[model samples]
Target: MPSPAPSSPLLTAFHDSYHELVRFVARRTGPQSARDLVHDAWIRLAERQRSEGRRPEAPSDERSTPSPQNIAPRAYLYTVADHIAIDHLRRGQRTAQRFDSSGKEDGPAFAASPDVADTHTYRQALAEVENALQQLPARCRDIFLADRIDGASHAELALRHGVSVKTVEREVMRAMDGVEAALHRWRGETAAPRTGRRRALSSLLGLAGLGVSSSALWLGWRQWVPQYQLQLATAKRRLLRQPLPDGSTLTLDADSRAELRYYAARRQVQLLAGSAFFAVARDTERPFTVEASDVQVTVLGTRFEVALEGDAVLVAVDTGRVRVRDGSGGVQTLLAGQMLRLPAGQSAQPQAITAVAPWRDGWLDFQNTPLAEVVERLARYSPHPLRVEADAATLPVLGRVHTTAVSGWLQLLARTLPVSVQPEEAEGGISTLVIRRRS
Candidate 1:
């Protein structure tokens, strides 16, 4: 066989760890100086390789061996950043000493006078960058602090949290890009005008991009929102309201979890567990879709709700129209004030939407819904695992239960229905509820 082609190990290493390495540097230095530090690190690495005579002699016939693939690039990149940050701090200390000995204030060179206009501009730019980072998701923020501040490895985090390494990598990428974009916008907006005295102003603006415009900032926000997935999870008896990337909003019910994804051609959400109400924004060019248990709902713009109960999917439309498709390729169109239940291996059964997604108003309305469904819905908000006997599970139930009052609703079931509620305590102070028909 012919000799295998030589790959650029340096390029591969940079590609694998560029985002995370820059984040590591940014935590030590400010975001504004992170780009320069990373660039300097790369230059020094190349110089070291050249001095050591490790440079490849030819593209096809390499003389020097590349860095071993088994060694993670993150460690190597982090080492380079550590040296850069130390040098930066040392230079700053030395400059401070010079100012002290010369009887001069240690302030920015651009702000020579105390009342200079540039001072206010610089402060405002920095404040905006900080505020933007604060608005990022909590998980993203935590990952950045752990990786950059504590110097934790991605594999270490994965093992500690019982998640895959890819999860940590994604979170780091999201936060780094988000902070970088915010700083870029800040620099672009606060760039000074080029004049006789400020001829170097153009060089400052070039760090962000070529041009500075509101459209550019908006486009940056749109593009960055899709790089990493956004997750919304709620604990028992707790509900959450989240804003979507497409200017829409969603309300997740108790014990629910969902993931949002916005692509060029479509805006999609996966209802991983429980129920959620979607107030989708109008986008005819890109239809909004919800993927749930064995069913998918597609709409251009609408107010709708999807509930994943067991193996079935329940869809309700409050406003606009919804198109639901089952796993068997059966399609059903539902309009405002309409609802449907799609059971596993069964066709969609349409019903009149009597209350326009009562859950949106903090109520779970059931009209002749099975007792088993009532128990199942209440279980999401209940602190204990709920179990219903077969006879009681088959009985019909009709009531509007409060989302946050699951215990009260179950108690009412024992009073009105021919069933008894029994609470069992297990080890570790854990409790469970069992409902069965009265003997």
Candidate 2:
């Protein structure tokens, strides 16, 4: 065989991390097929990179590149490998079904029995479900399959489809309703008007009577049903603290929003915007995870703060420990008093923090942070809209600004930096603060 060409930066990284990538896929698809899936993933990535190179550049083209600064090669490779593994498993399932239908000798045989009619009815129900799925919109049907067949998480589906987790949940529910209605018709059961939310419960009970395994039923419920869900938000200049169902406490900063989802197997909070402080209760069985921007912070029991600051996701650990992973697959472990900042399309590095979420105490701390980002955080608590000019926005700032005394800080800011702070009254009697270069 001819020798392979020298590897590019991405290919080199893949070669170096081949074993680790195999192990990642193995945990999902088993060790036997992990190597093949990882290799296939690399091939797909290489092809994608080539295709991207040939395409015209556009403002919205955020494709992955080999540069370490653009993305974490290992993380991107893992994501590709994980998707390939799912497809591999799905193909295997389809192939097995085909073999069984062909009456292969090695396939399991059904002996003649009095329960044959039940078997026929069960097969018919499955056909009805398939037919119902085909009638759904393409995206809705795919979301349903990804949830039920591939076991993708709601967060994962949301990310993949560029939608919110709530949207994913709605699509899955729509799919289930269609399938259940089809099954009802197949079973000759009269459809009564449902007055309440017992439809899922009734559907599960009906499937149980059709001889679905207890384990399957339990898994289905866990995948599609939520024990409880809560939406938390804070208005401008206001802070709120609320207790979670798991006995943990969540403190939301001004202009922040989060969605709390408690499942039988996990506890998740999607930080939709702004920042939050979590004082978690110890529960080893169900780990707690907070998703912000493209980053995830996971802990068993910890006091931590996650903030979506500008284009970065900031995770600060006040106590205990946290595992933070970004979209590109970069993972960092932070201990008490440590913090990690994941900037968009950049590598993350852990640093020490003197305080976590000082904004909770009415203080905004900046350490060589961009002026624009500082203004953004301040704007959340400001009654008036705040805007920073392009020339002044990039200036580095290092100081603490009291949240309640922002006007005073603005006076000092004008004196310290070559910038002008101007407040203008707009229509609707609202004042807007604009920061511009002094020149």
Q: What is the lDDT of residue 403 in candidate 1?
A: 76
Q: Count the backbone clashes (under 3 Å) in each candidate.
A: 0, 0
lDDT of 2 by residue, 1-439 (tens): 0011134455556757766776888898776556545544554554444556531111112343343335666665665566666655565555455435556756653322226664554555566766777789988987876765554756678889999866876787688678767767876886566432323322433543332322233344454444557999999889999999899999999999999988767899999999999999989988999999888889999999999988888999999999988878878789999988888756677898999999889999999988999999988877679999999989999999888888778867987789999988889988889999987
Residue 60, model 1: Cα distance from true site in angstroms? 21
- Please give the TM-score that candidate 2 achieves against the real structure: 0.57
Which stretches of candidate 2 lie above 4 Å from their native place?
1-215
Q: Estimate each model's TM-score.
A: 0.50, 0.57
Worst window of 10 by summed lDDT in candidate 1: 193-202
Please list the C-alpha lDDT of all candidates, in the order they appear. Answer: 0.66, 0.72
Give a tens-digit lDDT track for model 1, residues 116-178: 443354445445544655788876665654664444656677676677766766676566555
List clashing residue pairs in candidate 2. Answer: none
